[model samples]
Target: MANVVVLLLSSYTSRLATSVLLFISVAHTQNTVVFQPSFLTATGPKTAALLLGNTSDISLYLRTVSPSSETGSIGPPSCVAEVTQWVLTREQVGKSAVRVRLSLDKNLRLCGQNETDADCCPKPLCVLETLQVSACVGGTPQASLLIQATIHALLVPSTAGSDNKTVIPNQVYQTLGSCPCDLTFGACDVRCCCDKDCSTETLKLFASHCLLGPFGGQVSPAPDYQCSVQSAEDSSDWFPFLCVQSPPENNPYLGLFYQGKTIATKRGPSFQRPILSAPLPDNVYLQGSPIFTVNDRYFTIPQKVLGRCVTNAPVAFLKNFEVECVTLLHSCPAGAPLQTLPKDLTVKVKNGQGGDAEVDVIEEVATDLSRFISSTDAVASSDERLACENVTLALDYKFYWKGNSITRISVTRTVGTISLNVALTTRYSAVFLNGEFAGEPNSGNPGYQVGLPVIAGIVDMLENDTGSIQRTSINLWKPVGDGFCSTAEKKPVLFGENSTSGCLLPVSGQNLTQCDLLRETVTSLQAALITATYVAKSGNPDYLTMTDWVNISYVTLNSSTSMDNNTSSCYGIPSHQHIHVWSLITSTVDGIPQRDIRAVQVSYSPSTWALDCGGGDVSSCVDPMETQLFPITSSVTFTDIPINTGPPKTRFQINFTEYDCNRNDVCWPELAFPITKYYTGEPYSQSLAKGLILVFFFVTASILGTPWRQIRQAWSCAAL
Candidate 1:
């Protein structure tokens, strides 16, 4: 009978252990198996309460992360709130759970006194009324989780036989699933938590249309916990492209917190280049030369489209721009068609000069360049072919010279029928000498004529092509004939002249544009020159130019005269000027290096005077009668332009620091992509984080293959 009793006791103990193990395992699996809910979401502050179910009784716990004396509830939210971690107490702890009513004093839901401020959340000696508790004890963990459930008081008796003995096993949680979208913690409501508006269909459609996802917090549909979407401005402060900070708002109830990275799209500081570097289509000239309206009164080249991959070019390629004659004319004559200038015709250059050189530095340019440059009729033979008769030939040169001199300077232009030469001569000479290149004593010698070749090509094109001069860049090389040895930086002193006028465009349109207006063409050219000067004078590497464009503003003569360390053979003369000249070229969009264009030409005179000429003639100067120039030209094109895109937007990511329950440390796994709906038709269901953590732990335990039931039975028997 004694042996039988012992065996029966053993069997009973085993059954008891099995029951306990099964119950614990099932509860653990159902409660904390995965730290995440089936569907995870976010909400804004005002609607944060909606994330919770009205029928369910849920309690929240907070543990401060950052050091802040102010303690209060997360209410009256205007933006977003970031918290350290949170814990949850559900109404499911059996009889002990009944004692767990929210402590009004320590709940934090009601305001309390703060250390620095009177209006703060108050603390209590015994804030919690429940006997059974899962407490968070110590230092910060990588991750923590909050689990919730509905409890019924007096469901079961206490497990302790007597005075205050705790016996419940600690539950651990793992993460499972994550949401695809971002959720605002305080902006959600139960009514809209999983509503049609919050459905995946709507989000996907929005993403496709606006190229950005709506805020994550607009999921909850509960009245008090309803969520509202926050605008992009709410994510950060002014200058979103620069600094980032925490959202300025209170925390929302039952919402998510996340940090992460995502793909972004933005406009490049410069333009894009095509892979196939080519030139604009050759003009089909009616005779030997390009077709013109008034027999050289104006010249026009058929507008053409360039491709991508033609990297490293300037914007001056389209310096002399204009509309096709047919596009502007009321009608074309049958036999001898007359091309007319368009009232609103303008000029444009792709990669004016160094556009291609700086191509590699730009992050990304628009691939679909067709949007920037387009033409309706392109077929050459078809009647749809645009007659480029309204083309304008913007001039780029102005010559100046002194009076009463044999050496003359003038501007000569020759297009198809428009060919003329203008001579600029001085009427008087302040300083003059017979036929010698030397000027009079203290007077300035003026010349009969001075030649300016900067705008020579432009004038020629206009004279021969019947083109209009809507815009142009003319350089004036002030040949300071060596005589006045004044050591001073000489910037052009615009007395009675306009420095910003001429063929340059004004600064009014977008990226220097004005509804295809001829006036805009000139203003843009001027703007390009100013841009180039800014770059050269500032000495910023980001603004270095590789190609000289149409508007070659001025060659900065940077001279340095510093004392040298060696003074051995230096007799007494002061310092010598070490001068270097950098040609400043400007395009509509400055700083570009190379580009596709009809033609490119440059003419400049070589240095005429040597510093140490013959025998110590230190005061010698350059002869005003001598001047030379060399000209060169290159043609280019662009082939394939890519497509257009928008800005960048990213979603939040949740990371699991670790799995811990002691001292109520919540281990929340970072949420993955968001889900559309989260209604489980039950209260106390695991959240996305809690569910995932619990699931991980459950799987781990299963993999361990330990006989938990047998272990529990043996332990129970021993205790008995």
Candidate 2:
């Protein structure tokens, strides 16, 4: 999974207003404070201090009590209006700027989940609200105030015994004051002090000096506990850390003039490293490219949190202050394709019985061949009457065809005793040829040196019992030679326990025999032509790649044999039936039939053979004999059933009969390999060939066509 990122921005402002009333020979400062015009609640009806700033970098600090004091009915009896204040701050050369704003905590309102009353219930938990104060300035030495602020009762409540108390419940609060002494622009100190224990001596001094006479009486005394409050809406209230210049200006030092500040740019003060910051802008890390080619939208803010309070203008006494925005963005990365393992293989075998038999046969051949002998030659005879007794036979043979040619042979056999009318086993005569052991004579032909090794069984049935004799049941062992078992006169050979390593059909059972040692290996050389076609149709190599194609060849690639010699190209024997299989991965699900595909061609040549014979003693020597080889000139094409289109489930039906070139007497219901494809997603769907039948044929044709094209071109030129 990938990740995503984003950005946001946050800023705020604060301001104050005031007035002086002269009546009956008295002059007094009557400060009315109001917050901004945009806030989530009302800010009024509470007691607070009204501090005024003057031009000498000084602030005239004063305290004012609300008309409805602690003993009063909470507010001005008949006046529901909020008292707005003009904030005045002294600038250089006796100039002062006046701005309007609401007071702190007292200007806030309350809320309840179920309360519907306009003044009391169902209020906003927190909202940005504002109030504009009427502008006013002081009569004394004044300075133009570039910025102003109104602090009110929304401040955290002071302990009851202390002056740190608030009139409104659940309201945010703040306060306003200036540097008590000469100070730099960002060096003012602010604090919240509990005024519960005002000294009588202090009150007496103020009254004697007439400082407390302006309000017509001695006012409530202030407290001594103090803390700093964060005004929610002030960018300067919190010193900024890193400031990115707005449009029309490219550098922070440029004083709103689109150029660098003369003094700050070249002087030592430079720019004060900002101490606070606003929030980030929005949509900074979204993916724009390879679309827009650039990502420039972003911002960053810094902040400190003190207990539950926060500050834009944080005081040195504050240990923790928090900065935050209403919304934030999360960052993430890009997308890419995922790789996974393939599903279960769709393997299949044409004949379940034969397939299992073949596996067992191969295992035996690769493992133990001597034990395979008894199981092969154990087929029961057709007409041996059952006498409730067992029958057995044994025969042995020796062939001396030393140079891969014709040679003489000898054989012998012994049969167990048995009654003729019952389950009979006969003793067999062992003939001798020139003082050498010959095979047992059968009723059909005497002393026929056939290789049917008998191990203790019936010798002769009768004249009419030629059924058993003709079927090679009678033993007549012989030797291996070129002319011994010629095409015109085929002979049976005992090929069970006595043979080197081969298949055998026992007389005790009806199982088919397997020839193990006599086998061929091949390579699929023409797979390139076949695979390119598949690649054009499928993008992924796993589906139809040449590497996955099963290669079928009659000759192993790196075997030690000449192209025209025996042991090469089907051992240079044109008469030998050599075949290759391009197996198909089939769905093993039941009820699917095999589909017919392409036809295979077997090409031949009698020019590929060599033989030699000689003795190291120089006593004898023999010339080589002839051998033939089959070569294919053209490839075949297999067209079968259509493939499945959708996912989750699919079935396949293949017909081997459509692919078979030779129609033999092998009997079965039919011959085909059936399978199904299991699909999980749209892109993984695939269509494979039916089986080895048609595929091999098409491959052979393709290999042959290449040379044929050149030959045809040459012939055409000669004729011209």
Candidate 3:
């Protein structure tokens, strides 16, 4: 899961000015998902209710629960009360479900206690925070979930158990299933929970088009909604990539530890090889070119889609941010109150576009953020929605306490002036038990026995196809592929060779050779993975001269003999397994020449699922391993590039030719080549004569009842 996410992110992010900020909003129940018409207008202080239903067969106990302040709310919401008289009482012991009513505390005010204060409050926008809850099965720590919650006075309090509905955002809805389409066929009713846009026509269109149509099967390109994200003044801020948090001074991957790795570039500062590796205390090798941000320019403003209600409403962007101060309160403690960092954070927001202030980092704002309020009316109408723009970034700081040393630096990103990077900073509480920064684990095993070949193939995606500039990783698994780094070992095929691990895709062995990941082509995948890296490695400043595409066969096992269905391993599994991959990078800027980047075409027959159970029957196949990439071939190109001034405006396009993997998409396949159940360290015979000898030996062993132990010994002796 982690590796896939990282690869998908890193692969598609080359054209981005910076890396994307990955904010994982974990969902609890069907109720905790993203829903449509997500934004709700709040006129004033109001009550919001949440009803949690546990479908587990056993009694479930609700323990600690609350809304984390990461939502950027003006005040803390007490789960106990909706009004003066009523409190959240249903959250008692041993109940399958419970209803909790939340309301602003009597003393809790959106604006400061003092009305004249400049930091009273910023213009209000409907913020979707999380409803964090801890549940226990029979009081034995079951699990915790973060349910999505929107705080607004005008929101219709969702009745719990509302047909087990969720507020999945439009994207999430499409990902989960076709909304109105599924709803029409009764396959699902996800749209019923959407911000109630269901008209008679919408329903009819959904049914006729989705279910009852001749062109129905599932929409090709999923539908998009008026979804929006918070806007930052600069694209870099919103899509955090770089970092003030210096790379590991001892890590060799970033060339930081390579004391003499400084390579002089044609223009600008000296550069070094940006590859992932550990430091070598003895010596170092360096010199690789990469694209760095010559300059930065702000892009689209961040926003939260408010449906068609405020479709044409004015969108605001942050002009600049100010951090009055950053305080070191106390040592970390479990469940202690969160004393907000960056003593006073404020944003100077403006309507429409904002000017570039050569934005980097600022210490203090003119006034406190609480005082950064817009002139929008105190009352919000259904159509008149507020675009509460907040640009959150990261900043590094160190504090000394009474002559003592502070080695590990604690990080913060919410509010205040701070340096931002792609790393996941602290979100909500530090306690993992409360489901803080919670996420779904990527651990699934299918029955098709896809084996390790597909796993290796997937891991190949994490190769060091680094662009000149690299984004810091924030996903749960940052050092992507760390999970598989040493998960398995590859035995040496030749007698004198040593076994190697972590080389699943390349399938490390004496046979593994320098078949360059980039096969010198005009369009190749590895280059697209790191366009900047490709630019540097290409050695051509103006033109990427690896002209013309190359036709390369699917990477094979590097074996002398090709074992097919005609032959099988001792375990009755096919010795030779094939995985098809074709990744190409090609692009043309309208005004610029098209002599940059490279491409490689890979062709191979789609493999079949190595079913372990039944005789590979489609129905009997439990967990199917995909034998081919849906798009057996894929390409990415950057177009309409503005090279001169202004930020590089690149149109990134991916030509994906989909194919059937093992039939359905339910099963995910990994690389299992170069890996066999048994290790013989003996190469196969290429000639028919040698092949016959090998076949005769196997047949003789089987007929004479020769054990595996004796067979291995005989093979070893023959090698000797």
Candidate 4:
């Protein structure tokens, strides 16, 4: 009986243990598993919602629990919650067994007994600890299913920040402050009027005045509001009180709000001004401002667009510029108004009355268009076949200005008529002149400065005209690939640059008369190559004497040589010419340096070579009708004569002394010696003698004042 009783007790104990384990498993499953989302999403700043599985014949309830509450009891009623039936369409409910929707207020209240103790809720105010879903059957209350979770509802602050009264609005005012350029610390900054470090006495002693006034340079004067008021009063139906005030209110709301706890915006890498299609005109133009036009747009000229002419190239104020481009013009019939080069050009000027006025100062220019017509047979025929083509050859603009404002403008156009589809070269140049005092550019005061063109002219020494000298410029070889040389475009030679150029001369004739004409033409062209017989040393010739002029030496071309040669071969064809210029630099007794041209020598190659037909001696003459090509070249070289100017005028010179290491390999010891020396009242030898005497006295006192008896007694004790 005892054994059976023991077995029954053990069995009962095992059964009890099994039941406890099963209960624990069920509770763990309930707490760990949840059908709803883990977090509640915010729909608004203070409103949140959760999505979960839905079921019919079930009612749901929600409650908040403080994370710090250990007893699993409900904390303060911080948030309210509600549930709504969610209906999902077929597409949304595909293979889904549950649908859910629930909402909660994000503005949770804190647990405090009195209003004074109430404070802002924590970051995550309440946690949805448990969701009670009660299932009913046929109107009878049934068992409830508890879905345990640790979901948190975030307390999002409102973007408007209505509760925060001390928050400042995000706004920028254009008020002047202290000088922005005053970077120095604890010291007065030069030209900084608003610098607090600058005292009244120090400011008075400034060498230069402040560029910006007491206010910083960033501030501009407020526009005149009285002008608008007066204009409104002048109107028939307007009143002064009805005009809107220009000043801003003391507490104007900008309607800007913070989106989150921190207020910040992502900045761009670089800053660029906003571009406008047509810029508005301003009363006054600052530095680098675009030039204004009459049509409320920036002034622009036709510039090269992909190697072709296109309009609307903007120009800046106070800038001198020039551009050369090839342009095409549409056919203008015989009697149509010659297409003015610049179709739309009028400048707007400030009239000093708070308004802009248009000025038609651009003078209308007309040129003889017939002079550009091609004389070739093919071009002549093509010109008749097509309509007349008018083109602008050049456009020159002269702007007269007084103190940052343009007062007048002068435009001159050089136009010409040409054949169809012919590319025309157009030159555009602009210059700014001072309206107050307009004067020509000076080469120098008393001596010619470097880089100025040489003052030269031709002397026509004829039997009747002895003193008839015409002012002429140096010529450069310009070839257009027509097998002949041309000087249509003359480019002047500047000083100090040595240059050489050449062109092909075509000699063609059928008989003696044509040959003679060709020879004369060649002779005339060669003679005109170096027509300047004399050149002034300086730009101002009024104070120049006969010695100040430099005469050019060259071989005179005799026109009788070609006539004397009866042969068909052409003679006296100038092959090459060289110009040698010498410069002399000298100084006056007062040490003023001057530059003058010392000598000018012009030499030509031998002109004895004859061009004979049916021979390839100098140049190929394969065809009788074909033109014979002869090469013509010219060169100019400059040489400075070696002359003593004067003594050096430099006031300061520095020399560094170093030990010569190459003279001796053991020079490091000398270099290592210290340079600083200590000086005494007496000489070096006397100071050395005095230092030795002090050293001897100190040694004698240390040697004679010794304790010898104590030392002997200590030694005897050590021996014992």
Task: Give the per-residue lDDT of model 3 (tens digit) for 47-88.
Answer: 222223343432322222344369854332222312221122
Worst 10 residues of 4 by lDDT: 1-10
Q: Model 1, 1-720: lDDT tens per residue? A: 111100000011101221111111112211121111211111101001111112123233333222225763222211122242223234432321211221122122223334554333234221222111112213212112221221211222335466867654322211121222324454422323222335565545444233122222232222222122212212322232343333324323222322222225455544563244564333222112322222222323233236221211221211322222112222332321122222222222111121211111111222332322223323234443433221222211111213321122112111111111211111111111234332211100110011211111122235455532222222322223331212111222111122211111112212212222422332232222222221111111111132312333332222342323221111112111111122222221211222112222222112211123347542322332222211111111112222233443223322322432222345243133121123343311234446678779988887565777678778999999
Question: If scored against the real structure, what TM-score would every candidate get?
Answer: 0.15, 0.13, 0.15, 0.38
lDDT tens per residue, model 4, 1-720: 111100000011101321111111111121122232233332222221222222343343444333445676533322233342212111122221233333332334433334453233343434334444333334333333333433333434445455756644342433333357577889888877667888998878763466543234423332223323342222333334354456523224222232233535455545554443553435455434666655556666555656665556665556566666653433543421234534444556452223454534344334654433423234445444464544455667776666556667667766555556444445676676786444233344556666766667655565764444445556555554463676333455566678777677665434322655665665666566666778766555432244556677776556565445543465555667777878777542112456677777877664644446544353334434545567777777878888854665333212212334445555553442222123345433445557678779988866565665567778899999
Local distance difference test values of all predictions, in order = 0.24, 0.24, 0.27, 0.49
Top candidate on TM-score is 4
> How displaced is residue 131 in candidate 2, in Å?
5.0
Please identify which of the two predictions, 3 or 4, would achieve the higher TM-score against the true structure: 4
- In model 3, where do residues sit more than 4 Å from their true spots? 1-359, 362-541, 544-605, 614-720
lDDT-wise, the better of 1 and 3 is 3
State residue 693's C-alpha deviation in candidate 3, in Å.
68
